[model samples]
Target: VEHKVLAGPFARAFPDAEFYATDRQYSFPLNLPDSFLGLPPWTRPLPESGAASDGSWGGEFDHEVLTVKPGPGSMYQDAAFFHGPSGTLLICDALFAATEEPPPILTEEPEYLRALLFHARDTPQEIVEDTPEARRRGWRRIVLLFNFFFPTSAAVADLGVGPLLNLRPYELGWGGWMPFRWKSREAEEEAFNKYSAGGSPTMLPIIQIILSRGGSGEDTLRWVEKVKRWSFKRIVPAHLDAPLAMGPEEFAETFAFIKKGRNEVRFCDQDVAFLRAAEEGPLSFSVYKSSLGVLRGQPCGP
Candidate 1:
């Protein structure tokens, strides 16, 4: 396999990160000999033991083994890679199933990897493929992860599904696979509506937004408006120190005010409630962009 160098732009954006080490013989933490800005513990390998069930021995084999743990501190920390204010690109070993693990790291070798990037509005097909720039840079197997947030309008595009499209086929080899499971949108909406009616702290809609497979820009704006309205009516008055509320239309006006870059909006009780809900899981509000050029969900603990 060709040893591809990390992209210069990526390096510049994340000065402290390092390239993946191919050697498995080396030990954890120590194995990452290259200098890196201190990363989280999950990035390092930890000693663990798992039982082997072959049924032939009739006994479980218990042994301490070295394993890699994925965490926010390592590759995930560089929010620029996942979600940027505009767009971003990120590279990682594997995108594991939500239930299997935290941030899944590839350990075995078929050299599996995931490349994520985002675009502004429409996919720049020409720029991605048949372009001297990318070809000269030695980019192969570019697969497009359709933006779940904006499907009809892709945040990034121009890549094909399989290797035939100058991209590699997604394979389940990195210890696990992408769990095709997603939360039910209708269920989430109902829960959100119920919460709003009763002024109960809930995170269903936020989770739905995060896990949504596709929607238009208008849809996103609409959803944001809904969030704002729910916050205003249900969470704000009940939670905020100083009660303030706005309808969906009024919240849009407030959003416009914030977007004007005039003044920062102060956190209200509703905001705190939303944040707390996000922290509790079943919700994602990460604004960081990934290499695929889309905002990635916040890291939810396992």
Candidate 2:
């Protein structure tokens, strides 16, 4: 932890300054076994998740670290930084608020527009009109598909962890998920409402998969509670919109599904079919014996 704090660009920028991550981040990085996100005043240490999650605070903001045991494809670790002075909350991939328009940074790259226009078309051979209406249509599709992985009636076109490239080759137009049908604009708009929880921020499908599979969501709920303790007037995620006008309560509401302890958080169930299949298949974990299964580290099975 000290290494991460002292070795990066920040360390280089201010060689005289000291640095530290949040409690769990400093104590349990790369997820020390059984560790989970926790609450903090940054003075007292809490013993949970098989270790002492120490506290640290300084500089101009408060930070909270969240480490989750979600399997592959999930945000294994992230932290939230709240700058009380500015009422701004800094967050990474754990949360997102999809924007109606593509972020200007992305649009600066012309290939991004082509990527959007390509998605706007249902078939590879279909033409993508360059009108504002066509751009809006394409942007919405990109956001939905990126968030849901595979929205109903829409096939995937490489939700790559890297940049979104213009994949059309030799004037053939679109390359991935060719011939797939896209849902009507009206239906896609409705789906956005469901995913965004009626125009507010919501967990990305990839991240929600973690809560849904977290065995009644107890671990994740605990984390959400810790985050809700923060007082942030706005949230700025690593991706998507910046400086979202959201109070802490509005942010917490997105995780209400975890409080229910089930997969009741519906965002077009059909759209998340792939996510469902994952929890039940490749990412599933369970008790192999008695109540001691967890104690014995036998909580996961084939």
Top TM-score model = 2
* All candidates: TM-score: 0.16, 0.65
The regions of model 2 sitting more than 4 angstroms off are: 1-58, 71-75, 153-168, 171-179, 214-216, 285-302
Give lDDT per model, in order.
0.25, 0.57
Candidate 2, residue 144: how far the Cα is off, in Å? 2.2
Candidate 1 lDDT tens digits, 124-154: 1212232333221211111112112211111
lDDT by residue for model 2 (1-302), tens = 32243334554565555443333343223433222332212323323321233443344666666666543333345667778788888887777876566677656777877777777776555677777767767777777777766676334334453222434453424344353456466677666666555346767766665545434256656766777777778899987777789887887877776664444544666667665565556545421111111110011111
Worst ten-residue run, lDDT, model 2? 292-301
Scored against the true structure, residue 11 in model 2 reaches a CA lDDT of 40
